[model samples]
Target chain A: MIKKLRIMIGTNKKNILALTFIFSSLLVLASTQFPPWDVPVEANDLENPITVDKKNLDAGKAFFDLSCKACHGATGLGDGAVPSGDFTTKAFTGQTDGAIFWKIQQGRGLMPSFKAVQETSLWQAITYIRTLAAPQEIVAMKNATIVIEFDESNSKKLITAKVYETLENGEQAPAKEVKVNFFIKRYFADMLIGGSNNYTDDNGSVSISFPEGVPGKEGKLQVMAKLDDSGFNPAGLTEEVAWGVEKAAYWNDDRQLWKNNDFVPLWLLISFFGVIGGILIAILYVLLQVVKIRKLGVGR
Target chain B: MSAETTDIQKTGRSLKEITSDLLNPIRSKKSSVSLWTMLLVFIIIIGVYAYIYQTMTGLGVTAMRDYTSWGMYIGHFVFLVAVSLVGSLVTAILKLLEIKWAAPITRIAEIIAVAAVALAAITIVLDMGRPDRVLNIFLHGRIQSPIVWDVTVVNMYLLISVILLYLPMIPDIAIMRDTLTDRPKWQRKMYKVLALNWRGTDEQWRLLKRSIRIMLIVIMPVAFAIHTVTSWLFAVNSRAGWDSTIFGPYFVAGAFMVGAAAVIAAMYIFWATKPAYKKYITSKHFDMMGRLLVLTGLVYLYFNVNEYLVPGFKMQKLDGQHLMDLFVGHEAPLFWATQIGGLILPVFLLCFKKFRKPLPIFIISIFVIFFAWTKRLLIVIPTLLTPTFPIQNVPESWHHYIPTYYEIAITSMTVALVLLIITWFTKYFPIIPIWEMAKENGHDNPHEKVVLDDIEKD
Candidate 1:
């Protein structure tokens, strides 16, 4: 009967072990299955306006190195720290430029939205991503200049920048289709102020509304406009504006609990030293009594 | 006092017999004792080797990483600190309460306390990755830190415990110096110097008693402070398991329970190994200790209920996760085992008279002590696992804590060192106070009486 019971117990143990193994495997499979990201139909139908060239590809590569390389891998093989989807796959290359642009513009889960990135830069990044699947050749551009002007009318703050190109005979003409990005100069990186889709019109001028509530040092903000088109040399113009709230410096050096040891609260110090001193004195008295006991023993 | 004195005198042996019986363990050398000592020394040597390797390599050798940084070493430190409280419990608190039965076991408790606390100090150093730069704590020490307070109180308690152990042993040392003439010259001289020329004169007795009375009172707060400050090391943190106002009292109560179990375990060992110890440390002592364990166990149980149930009921997000881990998650088995086997069952079993017998209670005490160590680990590690922020960016192995062999070796070394110190003390000094036992048998000055008896014999 004991041997029969032992055999039954062994079978039960095996069954339980098998069940646990199967359950853990199922859990792992379920965790790896992520939901599919949905993109709007209109965003998928949008067309890429920027030309795929060496200059634009380099600019795209710079942005990809800064943000996407950490999660998407250096060569886009999905071998990065977080292990993203392989960009070199036919599944990835099969997607339309418009679909990829929408995915980048509207990220899901671990992917972050690139909505704040300038439209030209986003298109340039897409151009560089094409090379991750297969390498491409280089190209060059001509030089151009930009001039900026600020206007405050009907309580609306506006900034306009005019783009022009110099001909070989020294004649100047409007530089149409040039991308002009408006920014506020701040510590670290420049804060992008206008919408991402700013482009020069037939008159070679683009106007953008300056945003409200920008914090500046003593109400002075350096507004800058730059022409960073792949077809021309980059040029910039800066103008100081008082359309910012004055940033106040805050300082606190009070003697509080969180302060350093030099500024320890008085009550804590008193209580700490008071209690420690009282106990030490009593211990000292006890030690002194031991000495007296030794003396008494010796006197005898 | 007179009635009790007469009662004890009925079954009491002569003062001379009392002295010899209590001191016999020191005089006789047993092979088993030597074997035990050798075993402890061997383990300590392994621990030292592991520690050297750890220092040469780095803490990377241990499983401690970004998370679960405080592992078995800190847990062992808490255990030592907890066990060390038995010193103040039996030696000071019982002595102050005028509990006469505790006199024989005071030395045992004091020895355990001294060894445990001393090793506790050492264990903290072992936990440090840079054991060499330990002086940075002193060189740049700030009074605002709980660590500084812990250092201060632990050192003070060590000093007071040593004095408490020494002051009571003076009369015994003097007896050893005069009577143990066949002992090695260095041993005799060592006793002579330590005895401080203790002649058991009325004046010397007066000074000795006065000093002991002062220490017995003084040690209470320092003892409380040591463990309370130690508790603050955890309670001061805002972690779910450790963040509680009652942790100070909770820890103190638990310390008392664990310390009581340690004393019983030691009592049984002495009673079993040294046949002479059976005469002095009887079943009656075990029975009393069992009752004390029941009392401390109940108090600790009360704190444990408050510590867990209140938080468990509310089940705040982080606290809920932490409590669930302890109650039904990965840690539940060890947690339940500690609560039931270590605590609830022992407390319940010890209440009955049959289980309070030497053999049964000794077994129970062993379970209690073992669980108590694991209980400390539970208190430390589980809360760390349920950190406020999710554990990310590290390897999956870093999520859990399983102590490496090197860590285990170092921790075992601390335990072995405590046992070795206790064993060495038992080998040299009387495990029970010779003079105190004689005094209980109605001799006013047992030390002088032994000298007089010697002169008469000569």
Candidate 2:
């Protein structure tokens, strides 16, 4: 009888488990459909009015920081003024400049209408928006490539910059005597650090060194190598190295507890331990009294 | 002034007869296995299963996200700690004051305290995402954090409360060991070991009295410290509802109120279940508990006024949103109902002589206990929702905290576990102090009942 009951229970359990699996798979399939995002046909064909020049990009960045940064985020990573949605998807950059312009002009849901900003300014914003894609991706270069390496293991800050020229058959050859400018990245702009301009060696590498114990925010020194816009499109890359594992010295007066200050007050320590100690002693005394009573019986 | 004389007036029974009647509970203390007991066991089993599921699954089984980091579990933690303070109030404060009416209720109060505090510890563990990392609190604890202080005081309070509960029960355990001859052998042996050779000698009585007195004196501050430190956990964070200089005393006063109400509820339950316990836990005991509840309630009411109304009168920008939320927003109805129906109506009703009757007091105390728990939720949830900085870059779902099915099941299990612990304790031991009642009736040497009963027959 028990064997028959066990078989029945086991089969029922199998059926239940199978049903649960099917139900969960159905839920997974149902959630894959994306919501419709309507776009105008004219937006795809409209040409960008603003040129991708240095001056226009800078103005666009300034305007983006003022207005669009609140919603679209600083790097347009979708972590912005909005509470929902991943705005940093590839779809953000996949759209044409005109499509992005139309989206900006026509606000949907939480997005506000940006028609208030003029056409040239909007186009410039779009130019800046193109740079919002992953900064680590090397822009395709016909002539040269810039690579930066930051090494901070030793007692000195070392930044190695190398430039390579691409031949017609797609082979990389070292480009000697190329001037590389190394800068430490700051809040708004990069500060020229150590040798601002140094020519690469025969190996196509330029190494710049700075003194140890230099202070930086959050214990990081961002080293940037720039090949200025002289012949080919100016190429630059940045790499961060550890400085000191402490906040910048200028922020020493900050009230942050983790930054090497006495986090706890002395009085709090005394009061807490004092209470604990008193309780411990009292409990000890009580237990000892119980033991004493048990060991020696009371007299008549 | 004679204890014997008072017993004669109260029950018209001599010391010997009274002691025999009192010992009846210990002799007859078998597991009755009622429907209620069975139901509690079933629920407890389900609760344990839920907790295991929660542990295997992450705390994500609950709907708690970044914004609503704390939910019902924390509220229950604070509530349990608050309710546990009744042990200190009844056992220590009343003992020191020598209130004779409070004598019968201390064991019940202590049991509630032990059960609530033990469960309060578990409730906190439930709130942790990684409960195994709990040892890290001790390994690398920063004395700076209120969390460290909370842990220190809560542990201390638990130790002191347990010792206080045990110290008084030793003589009673000895009484059970000697008198309950027909009880199960294991039970008798358990009592024998727990009794620690208590002989009712003068030295033993002196030591027990001295130790109890010392523990009673020591436990009060530790009890105060536990709840005060609990309050600081929130108050130190600078949250709107919690960031007040008055939170420590406010919480302590509110704790006493809830603790008293919890004791009254337990007294009523015990009074209802044990048909033989009517003489010991009389309506007079309920009357005294009612007055005590009212007294504590008035103090809690005063703190509640200071907590809400003063800032509420001229609401500051930071305090405004929190106050409005409690006053007229989503939480307004529950908040107002808890305050008026739970707090004010009970206080007003308790002032009347008719309401102080056992059944009426029990009903009101039920309201008080219910409100006491919801009151902690009000304090925790509203302040969290109205954070000083605007919430950005999160889903709208993160804005509201709704406890999931698993969280609710686990919380309910903690309550059931507390009841189960209390149930198990009441099954073996006498709920009232057998030896203390004998001594109060001038049967100072409790061993005489075992020795003299056979002597009288011979």
Candidate 3:
């Protein structure tokens, strides 16, 4: 009697493998194609960044000083008392004066569309934003000799570069390409030596072989690395950056900065199916219960 | 086999013939320290205790985890319910078709129907995680759930089944009241109350017949609903083996199949006990039951193929592990055993004339019932073991569930409790419907009346 169920229940190994492949592919597709956490970022202002009126420029400058100046600085070199890095994005640099004026007239993304700000004020901010760049005299480092080494037995790639500085304390670090910005709180205020620039090698690793820049004597130098986002000062670092050629300083590979969320992607699909399952069980249970209770009450 | 010829042959064979001449029943209840009945009863008591413990502790006592929320209780409930459907085959199907061979066993079949359905109800309640919150169901009833459908149909089936068993017993109750001289006065009163002043009038008989007919017709759909809803509980879920479109019919066929097998097992037990019962039941009864088993098996087999083949062809990702688990993975042994031992072999064995004979048919029915039940267990447990995640977290014990000692005790208790109900009912009431039998045999046999009266007398 029991043997009746034993027949032909297994699929061939190859079939199982094929099933596994198909299932995995579907899992990948489901996770990637319909990601749940891609939060929307607005960037509409750049499409039309120009504003024409002189009155609008003044108004734009007022609005800019209220919001943008703290980040881009009074001179837009990002060197205010609290100074920040420049936010002269590609749209700002590439735009015509008219476009820049319009951008000040209307902000985009994190920049609230200040279309409400006077059109003149919007144009003024745009004109200022168009002039975004790093200040000139980078800091020179304290006079010091440094050693460096390259080890390739384990790793196959490395980046090599050097930097020098020309200024101290109030001089500030000159910004490089200004591609990215990171903000730091004011806890480490006593550590500033001040400005310089460093460069990057083709291999993505940075090694300062003859690294020299900033505070060039026995004092301090502020050197900038090619890894800088753009030429903006006051890039919101709390601690004063040390000026020295530390031996063989390099960055490990930046494998990836983001991870694809697994559970959330599958959540919607699972929930959809789960609800369906719940509905089915619910129906069966309710239908039966209603009849049972009714029968029990009615006694017929 | 024309009914005319069958009736003539039946007439030639005296209705008063004693079948107990060659065999005797192993007394169901032991007189001493432990009876076979008590063992089943003890297990049942422990099981009941376990149930009480569960009700207090909540469904946490069972090995059910998040993945396999519905566990052995529901499986047990489903098996018992399937067994309950056997009554329809005996009382409704065979009776309506005028299969005179069913005479001796109809009463027994009815008892099985009542007992199994009753137990099924208890077990389903046990299956609920929040039995306390069960009232919330009525308070907040939803038509969408399969559980509600099941509760509805099962209640209807139970009501109709109990009434079916009772209505046919009126004339016999009267016989117990007045004609049984050896019976004490109190017993007579009890019988009189049950008889409800029945005088065997033509109107009463007509009403009885009409009601039985109505019940039989009504019961068919209700029976389908109980099992079909059970299937939907699985099928509508987007789980692997459960998501099949064919589950409704599959479950129904399986229910009737297992049900027929249960009837066969009960028939054998009745025959073995030989409890002054053979005069009422004949060898032809066994043959008819065997035939019924075969028919159900074939229908179940058809559904099984539809269930397996469609999923196998599609090979969807959701169904992958579920199919593998049943067919080739961990559940394989039980799966195959249920198919072959529970369903196929009994069907094949009972297919033959000799195997369909009383004793062999009866023996095979037990195997079929055991296998059928295990099949239900496999259906539920394996799906849970393979829930989408690589099952992790919590105690490692959460990953697996072999029912605890107390769990088995409670399960056995349910089975024994059901058996006890059937036993008491049969011991007090003559299992053969006297009024129906007398009517069928034309009530003119002085000798047949004498022999039947001898048993009815006490």
Query: If ranked by lDDT, best first, what sequence of candidates would result?
Result: 1, 2, 3
Better of 2 and 3 by TM-score: 2
What are the chain A TM-scores for all the models, listed individually?
0.43, 0.40, 0.23
TM-score of each: 0.68, 0.72, 0.56
Stretches off by above 4 angstroms in model 3 are: A1-300, B1-34, B181-186, B444-458
lDDT of 2 by residue, B63-181 (tens): 67777889999999999999999999999999999987788889999999999999998888989888999998888887777787888788788888889889998877776676677
Q: What's the C-alpha lDDT at position A210 in model 1?
A: 84
Tens-digit lDDT string for candidate 2 (A168-279): 7999998777667777777786677765348789998988886555577667777778774222346788877775445544655533434322454556657767878888
TM value for model 2: 0.72
Residue B18, model 3: Cα distance from true site in angstroms: 9.5
Assess the local accuracy of residue B120 in candidate 2 as a C-alpha lDDT between 0 and 100. Answer: 92
- A229 Cα displacement, candidate 2 (Å): 23
Indicate the residue-level lDDT of A162 in model 3.
25
Per-residue error (Å), model 2, residue B271:
0.5
- Residue-by-residue lDDT tens digits, candidate 3, B1-458: 23433453466432232212211121133335337666766556556555665565556455676666767777888899888988887788887888777766787788899999988987877777567777766565444455765776777678778877876776566556555545556767888667655544444444545655666666666677778878887777677677678888877778787877777777677666664566556678777778878988899888888888888888777577778878897778888988888877887888789998887887788888898899888877777777666764333555566665445656777889888887667656766666556555554343223324433333
Residue B188 in model 2: shift from native, Å? 2.5
Per DockQ, the best of the predicted structures is 2
lDDT of 3: 0.58
How many residue pairs clash (N, CA or C atoms closer than 3 angstroms) in each of the candidate models, in the order given?
0, 0, 106
User: Which 10 consecutive positions of candidate 3 chain B have the poorest summed lDDT?
Assistant: B18-27
